[model samples]
Target chain A: MNKQKPSQILKTTFFSFLLIALTSCTKKSDKEVSLGALIAMTGPIESMAPPILDSVRLAEKEVNDNGGILGGRKLKVTVGDSKCSAEGGADAAKKLVNINKVSGIVGALCSGASTAASSGVAIPAGVTMISPASTAPTFTTLKDNDLFYRVIPSDAYQGVYLGKLVIKQGITKVALTYVNNDYGVGLANSFKASFEKEGGKVVTESKHEDKKASYRSELATLAQGGAEALVVIAYSDSSGQTIVRQALETKRFERFIGTDGMASEKLIKRIGIQGLKKSFFSRPVATKTSFSDAFDKNYGAFSKHKRKSIFIKEAYDAAMILALAIQKGGSDDRASVKANIRKVANAPGVEVGPGDWAKAVKLIAEGKEINYQGAAGANEFDKNGDVAGVFGHFVVQMGDSFKQIK
Target chain B: MDTLYGWMMYILSLLTVGGIYAIMGLGLNLQWGITGLFNIGVAGFFAVGGYASAIVTTKFSPNHLGGFDLPFIVGILFSMIFSGLMAAIIGKICLRLRGDYLAIATIGLAEILRLILKNEVWLTNGPRGIPGIPRPFEDLAQPWSEICYLLIILLILAIIFYGFEKAINSPWGRIMKAIRENEEAAASTGKNVENLRLETFVIGSIFMGLGGALLTHSMKYIGPTASDPLVTTFLLWVMLIVGGSGNNKGAIIGAFIIWTVWSASELLSGILSYEWINRLSYLRVFIIGFILQVILQNRPQGIIPEKN
Candidate 1:
């Protein structure tokens, strides 16, 4: 036994120590309330992540500036990348809940990430997660035990609204192409059900996986359905640009409708302003309130990345709600934060809008209830932690800008 | 105290996932390393195994079919059988192709399988995927359940490693290697190269299936994303190649090292500030590729060279 090489033993020991050092680095500050921001910092929806993450940091700074939560215990945010997939979401949630010891998580922008993280890690670990952008109705069925919440309305609402709007705009026939994931399938099914119910015919619906070299064949198949318009539900950074560009080049279907995922200036830049002139899309409205204004002003300071402002409002709102809940819950305990999240966001209290956290903290100290009306919309969560918000109708005008259409 | 536990649990999850991939790496080693068959559709057989188990075990739902509510062991057994059957079918036609052509065909098969999983809404439930998969011993409290599952993975990996080591050292394995070196020479020497290749392919795919089945159970979900060619197929190749092509122990070590690098990079991204993560969002990917390049350059025969 003693004949074994000492160098091999030394090498093995060194590697073991290195592994331990690499894995054991979580240290929670006693004077801080840590919140996790699990977002799509990479993967297919990478383009949309920066502004939303920036908004979260802005809200974090605002919370700390306003005397922090629970009498100067500063609110610190730890960001985790969801990568917009179930596995990515679950891994991120595990790190956030277990390693970071965050009282609450403020994202998971994609639906697949939201539900997966909840079932896989967050709910089991008793960590509260408030999604700012995940809108799939599938989340409504999660046996989350009251640990899951979201700032956006479900796709059910958006589908119904858009379906009605498509018909009202005199589009009688439409073909649909959606990304073949939870987000796409859920929204597509909802829209199909609503569109058919509204006496409109969906000529054909196709699902596309992301990162395909060309969607020309899918576009051709969609065009063959003799539809007057196409409804594309996909992220701008993925197959959305290619689908739009190919559809335009082939003159397959000039008239198009899109959802929030495609509501971006990048879409216009890719397809050109003239290419998308006949296109209209629906997305959650960014309210012109004090909260949004403050967010727009402060976002640049935190991040130099160009702001798309798509889900930035919701991100800010989610961060604010988590922080306020931490303050009202009176401790950094996750259970306490989860229990009191609704207390700070519902009605029958003094109204607190964006930038009013200092006042809201004062009101909470004075034994007064407060309702936080977020920059995105009314901050109310139903039994399922779902919100109801208005979807804005917009058209791409000249100069690659979105013009709100009444 | 909880932080320490959290870190431990996080490491356990990484090891568990790494263990599953180790099984896959072993299977690929049997095909590409031992038998000289480039079965690049590692994820295809994996998905087949995952769906086979998921269909039988999951409860009856309107979304998909065959919710037989079978026991967990039945699911695992069926997953292996199903994947083996698929490998047999694919190998029957594709084993005729050699080298690069086999690689191309297997990669295409993987894409075709992913498409089928996506479009066959009635069968695989399409992109929404099969969630709510019941993990064995899920009734146990969390971190404990997770730890138990990790043990299960480790047990499976150890069994596979032992079995694979024995198989590759057997007379049958020597014939496969002879065929891999020179098929014409092996055929002339009275070995049925075609049949041996097919048998090896099927056997290798069965191991991949078991790995996939275990992963699906642990994750409690299976989707198209889970079977991404880049993650499952390419990464397994990197694992086997980087660890050592023909050595079973090397394959396991490779899986652990590569998966640790993959996950650890993501963890680093999380630790870095948003400005750094945003400006260099692909830094994780860059680091992985750079490490692989360095390994490939420094050890062309792999960290553990294939034993003669």
Candidate 2:
């Protein structure tokens, strides 16, 4: 019995050591240049993520097709759904950085999700992040900073532009109705500040919680307030659509203005042509642009319907910029790649896009200067890592079409 | 100095969380410890309180509900009352079941409540949630006064604790204990066990509701995601168990200790640079589990075992 016990103990010890060695070996061999993409694939903000993910995939396919980055090392983009919540985003970020050992991350479509993931997982892991859509100003001023970058300008810039647009529309008194979220509040406050500064009067400012049915009374109140224009700042979800529909039904205001969150093809689809007409929304214009044609062609091939929203173009540009930066760095080293992102994205000279990246990459490799003007516009990352893009006011015309007011 | 201040702030934050959890734990203790009624749906009641108070206070428009912007005290009071009322209704239906069946029913109800919050965009703002809720002391001359906020919450907790203590000491508490020890024996002694259990369940739910309201105000943001089962439900259970189940002081102490550990672990993880430690985020959960196991082994009754 004693001899049998000794033999069993020895066998157990051998297996334990063998298991540890196997695990270590697996860890060492698993460096396939993993890059994490955290997007809201579910939850309230989920509608915004699918297009972003598609854009990331398109970029990945293009990179891999052209012999990949870092001396033929194929780039793998692992997408994680943040669910647009703090805890969920943090969990997704952790899994991406820890389990996948991803050197770089792109995503967190929602602002709150970005904040949660950035603070908890990405920054701590020293993984560089470039969000395509998150526009909260607070992210640029994080206390425990990391190599954070974004292709979209802050709501600060958008708010000013929106305010200017409102003033230019010859509307003096405006009624502001916003969803009670950070995204809405921040943009609304900024617009209010700049609008008031620009000599525009906001008659009645009210906040509505998102996703409630029947906004007829609120719309009526805004109408009753005798405001010429109503500014709706909210997500491009059902709630925002409901608000717009209710406003249209009431026929209260002369004009309706919406922010970027309301600048979506889904919004048009939800509200139909009749609801969308006479409504002017501020969005990053994609027409008469270099990459717009290419995006239209590529997205036309990929999607049954031609992609015509500003978000799709911005998301595509964000992915393209990240890929270009990786190509410029000549290595998958996260820190160096992160540092070089701003350089490649906001490079000097002619603007570039996914189609132009090959030539740009070759020139960059040969120590020549290049500028990447994306489909959305110039990918210029400002001092705070925000892009400076033109925010144009577009009036929805006939079915699925909008005319930008120059 | 900054580090110390941060730690102080963390402790203060934990105290606030602990106070809320303690109140929640007391409710559980009243049900499980006193009346032998098991309710795993504390989160549901808590969420109801938050949503109810939020909708009531905020104004309602044709498109969305607006907050009434009432005083925080009024909101808190309304939350408690509504939660208690909800508990009475739920208890009337499910409290008749004993043991695991009752637990399952409550848990299912909690899940249903969460789904309602998530899907009913018209009511709870769906998944996007409500933000920019008015802070209690925003109108104060010095607004960012954590001390004032802490003291106010602490005072509220004290009153609740005192009230609970007084109630538990009275004849009502004895009957509750009697029901807990042996329902049949209590019935034989001419006690209405069902009514006592229902009352205990309702009262406990009220505390949970109030705690939820207080918590929402502290964050100044309320979302369906925040009141999730994993975040609110699991944590409450951890707090109650770590504290002695039947003891209010133990509940408070457990909440404080566990929250401190959780916060400290997070801070440690944040500051550490090692790849292994940085990567091993789940290590914290494992450590918590291990510590809990050790505690259970060494002191099965908990940090402060309830005294009969």
Query: Each model's TM-score?
Result: 0.83, 0.62
lDDT per residue as tens, model 1, A48-99: 9888887888898888888888998888898888887777887778788777
Question: Which stretches in model 1 have alpha-carbon errors above 4 Å?
Answer: A1-28, A162-184, A192-285, A300-302, A305-308, A392-406, B279-281, B293-308
Residue pairs with clashing backbones, model 1: none
For every candidate, what share of the true interface contacts is present?
A: 0.36, 0.02
Per-residue alpha-carbon lDDT of candidate 2 for residues A326-345, written as tens digits (9 for 90 to 100): 67777666677777777777
Q: Scored by CA lDDT, what does every candidate get?
A: 0.84, 0.71
lDDT of 2 at A284: 61
Per-residue accuracy of model 2 over B178-287 as CA lDDT, tens digit each: 88888899899997788888999999889888878876765554666667665567767777777777777887787777765654454333234323333333665666
lDDT of 1: 0.84
Q: Which candidate is the best by TM-score?
A: 1
Candidate 2 docking band = incorrect
DockQ for each model: 0.45, 0.07
